[model samples]
Target: MHSVDKWIEIAKECKYLPENDLKRLCDMVCELLLEESNVQPVSTPVTVCGDIHGQFYDLMELFRTGGQMPDTNYIFMGDFVDRGYYSLETFTLLLTLKAKWPDKIVLLRGNHESRQITQIYGFYDECQTKYGNANAWRYCCKVFDLLTVAAIIDECILCVHGGLSPDLKTIDQIRTIERAQEIPHKGAFCDILYSNPEEVDTWAEFPGEDGFWGAPKVVFQFVHINGLKLICRAHQLVHEGFKYMFDEKLVTIWSAPNYCYRCGNIATVIDFKDADNREAKLFKAVPDNERVIPSRTTTPYFL
Candidate 1:
């Protein structure tokens, strides 16, 4: 068995693990994830986060602000990889934490978790550049396949990577999805991961893809029918780090600060003290002087 604690330390430093260690880590986490349902159930006193997008330093800052896992439970609503520099380290750290403390954290699938999406984004290239092969990327994708599609916090707040899907009505519908594969082009599964909340009167087609842009009425209907108090999702960039929509019936949490390294957006996570009482903890990206930026051919080291 690999020492997950050691791997956590290494990943926090923004260093990729050796090929063997990474493979083992993936295998370990995969076994743990395989037991999770498509719609996993989580308790409160948990920190709910949005997209990390491979911002490893910002993720570290998030831990600092919201409290670390096991100590402060977390439910990360996907997009763990891609769009940022440290996809490998960012994801590896989370995987390690999951393996070490499965009950304390929940990781849901984001639209970007798909193999096609990662290839088009940045994760595929990051793996190849870091390991001189696609093995690492493949291993991570396997974990992505097993990642839960959505999570319910304390049986009230519905958490998904994207917004409401037109094809699905209840949380049970989400539970029926076979999530152990690459995300499909259309249908409830795809829509759950790709849809977005909009201000329109009803559900609208999201341009260029299988997702939908949902309106306030759509959200209200879904929440009412499902007996849900709120729908929490993350897919769009909210410069404020978090945004409440449809009269707080739904919330969009964005945890990647200064997205893409220049968007100037603050990151935030929701800390649920209990099922009823929750707080939004906001944080900024780690300063350049505080983090090590690795070169294309070198491991990261403190400046």
Candidate 2:
């Protein structure tokens, strides 16, 4: 087995790992993820981040802002791949860190982690372009299948890629989901990964999407019934980096700053000092002069 530390250095430099080494890294991460629960429990002093959509440089900036792994525990809520220029390097770096320090890093599945979504978005093509085949992508998808769906920080704050599910009222119900396959079309599993927060009176269908919009009343009820103090999620892009709804009962943290490299929006992460006391650390996109931009290609969202 290759040293994860060395792989981390290569990934940070925007270099692709050899296909065999990448496969080994994926297998190592899969073993670690399989031991995690569907709703993993995390301790305090952990930083909660939102979508990372393959902004590799920005992710490096995030580590600088939030502090590095092992020393600073982190729980990434998902959307690790797609939409950016370095999905391969980005995902591989996270996988390497997880393999090296499983206790310090927590990766949760996002709506975009699915095979169908990646194929539609950008990860699939990026993999093809980088490695000249889909083998690396397949290996990464296997790791995605093993990722936990949600995480509970100190057993009080619920962290998920999307909002709550109508079919599942409690966190325990979320734990019962069999999440080792491709995301489903419509069900609790799909809802947990695709839903968004809204101002409706109750659970309402999200127009033009496969998920639902969780109403404030419904969200408050869910948190109260489950004895949760807060729900942190990321799916929508908030120009200010993060947004709180339902009187702070739920929060949306967007970590992909200057989204798509043109949205001109900032990014933020939640630094949980202890579970109750937390601070929002905001950051901007890495300056162009500081990093090398890869050759341009047509991204799905732009096309």
Candidate 3:
């Protein structure tokens, strides 16, 4: 709770998705990144986050479960809006931290950052109700532009919202993406933002559909990829709120507990404290009644 009050005060005035313009998000984010990109990267302690679908209170649970900020820089792997309730509350909290301590928080971009996705989920509507559609659209673009696609900490670990696509041969290529589109089209860029878990239970490779062609191959190719010990992401929903996919090389962190429509599963995260002590801990933050094994209706809400 470092300056939680001041943070909230700033959040009160923070923008929402409805107020944003989808076309200009990345430019704004790049500009902001340039301002603090000079901040020395540190491994003092880092929390690798998954996806948070508007569960702001659950984010508080994460802050309580993993530990607080300033002491440990937070890396949010996107989806700060849509689904659940309180998109504004959730984005405001994270935005406030970014505004207050730019050096301590690294927020990555997720597929849901786009206006198209938010419209289907809850954020777009929430914004209209709270800030009106016009404001929501404007804030949406600004927030999207502010998101980071990937973050390299001391060049040891690489993190993003989605896993590697088959065509992506290296990490450097990920950095060069202009990342300025309002939304991704079907291509290399779309593949990056829209990738899913590489599991038969979750995804079937579309041999020719091509989008999922190179995904499942990421783990086997890990040794060839340089400067990456692990790839962390959060896109697909986990029954437990977080699923460690791709034979552990890729980890999915869902910071949103009891995800969309209250499925009643708990979310989790990974913390790297030192070289040999990188740990994955799962905690149930959802209430017991809802935390039961989700029924067959437990489909991923990403659609």
Candidate 4:
């Protein structure tokens, strides 16, 4: 069986929807799959990245820090365009890279990818704010919809833009993201958007109220649930550019240096491959103590 077939089989087993529904859903997802096929065709020895929030210069630094693209298959966990000054340039550069090395880049959808979020957090708003928003909206939205929900490499590591959610009953649950849903609501879509890693979720009451869901058990559950070693995700600024959670069941990486209105903390990513037998480690693009920007802003991301 081919890789895609194996993915579908696993997704079918862990399906929340019935088989008939699964087929229908997959039929819709089929087009997305085809488009993605030409988008990032390679997937080994991949370097997984975290959030890149429109800091165009920093992103260039990141590529330097992380090393050249496609040489090591690239997986960007999400948050490619937002919160900084150069979303247009950043997104265009990434898209160009994707087009050139269609076989090497893995792009995941983040909270910012949704239309609503983009209207607020994407380059659309930034363009409007910075460039008067004339014709940017049309092209930016087109690129936004093309982003994928998640990417799994070698069935050993899973990657997503945000934290895990209670709605995810199994690993295959994420591996099989429908990727065909409309945005701007707090449904399964919101869960993906708001998902965050927190210890409280592990020992929380049923129907947890944090709204988004995640826990160490879920990591193990999903790992055992899917037979993968580690899940790598990007979202949540790690002062150190990356963080390890759930006894290392999940690793949170941030490729955006000086996240969230330029706090000045750098970023990091991990490179893994079959040659090294799927081993993973954290690589930093910048450092934490370096956040000495000499000014402070009251703007908050969590709120």
Tell me the alpha-carbon RMSD of every candidate: 3.2, 1.3, 6.1, 11.4
Model 3 agreement with the true structure over 118-203: per-residue lDDT tens digits: 77776766666676554644555566754667776656566767666655677667666667566565655566666765545333
- Residue-level lDDT of model 4, residues 1-303, one tens digit each, is 643344434432321223333334334333444577211333567788888876565666666766776566788877877666556556656655554455677677777765666666546655564456435544555456656776777766777777566667665555465554444445444565557777764733325422465777777787787777777787787878778888777888887665665566657767776523543343433443532221435232331
Better of 1 and 2 by lDDT: 2
Per-residue lDDT of 1-303 in model 2, one digit per residue for the tens? 458888988887878899999999999999999899999999999999999998999999999999988899999999999988888889999998998999999999999998998998899999998899999999999999999999999999999999888898888899899999999999999998899988888888877665998899889889999999999999889999999999999999999998988999999999999878999999999999987787665644532
Worst 10 residues of 1 by lDDT: 294-303
How far off is residue 34 in model 2, in Å? 0.6
Q: What is the C-alpha lDDT of each candidate?
A: 0.88, 0.91, 0.63, 0.60
- Candidate 4 accuracy as TM-score: 0.74
Model 1 off-target regions past 4 Å?
295-303
**Best-to-worst ranking by lDDT:** 2, 1, 3, 4
User: Which residue pairs in model 2 clash with each other?
Assistant: none
For the record, the alpha-carbon RMSD of candidate 1 to the native fold, in angstroms, is: 3.2
In order of appearance, the predictions have TM-scores of 0.95, 0.97, 0.78, 0.74
Clashing pairs in 4: 41-103, 42-103
- Per-residue lDDT tens digits for candidate 1, residues 176-243, read 88888999999999999899888999888978994899999888888898888998999889999999
Ranking by TM-score: 2, 1, 3, 4
Error of 4 at 89 (Å): 0.6
Best by TM-score: 2
TM-score (C-alpha, index-matched) for candidate 2: 0.97
